[model samples]
Target: MNPELAVLYAKLDIYGEALQTIKHESGAVCPNFMTCTCPPCRASYGSWALASEAIEKATKLSQSASQPEKPMSVCTKDEPD
Candidate 1:
């Protein structure tokens, strides 16, 4: 969903649930990133218009982007053996 809407919803004090509904209904969560592909919410494209445009560009750049890549593993060097 448009992360911005999430913020608005946050300000309204209904971020998790209400914002989610609005985001979906508003077509903010670009279908390309709807199912399981989209980057993390923190990395979201912000507004619906921006997200939609980003999705389109990503699609044109790589047809396979429809299926987002597996998340990169966190650096293991910080962990003790």
Candidate 2:
């Protein structure tokens, strides 16, 4: 539920899940929650900083990490079935 957890998930390349967690959980505790649409929430990001290492790790994590693939539609042709 912590923003830090989202950060960790982001580092793991699970951005979608990380974001869902952030918006639904951590964002709830924020003063300016705005459904996690805020450029910067009322809460200072520094408050979530556990240490300089966490900040450094988060910074080092690449935004280009591969995201989970979306599920494909399942439609079977009569012949295929």
**lDDT per residue, candidate 2, 1-81, as tens digits?**
899998887776664445445544553346645445455653533333333335455556644355566799987867654
The superposed Cα distance between candidate 1 and the true structure at residue 69, in angstroms, equals: 23
Query: For residues 1-68, what per-residue lDDT tens digits would candidate 1 score against the true structure?
Result: 89999887676554334445544555434445444345653244354445455555645866775668
Question: Candidate 2 regions off by >4 Å?
Answer: 1-13, 30-41, 44-81
Candidate 2: C-alpha lDDT: 0.52
Best by lDDT: 1
- List the global CA lDDT of all models: 0.54, 0.52
RMSD of 1: 16.1
TM-score of decoy 2: 0.24
Among all windows of ten consecutive residues in candidate 1, which has the lowest summed lDDT? Answer: 40-49
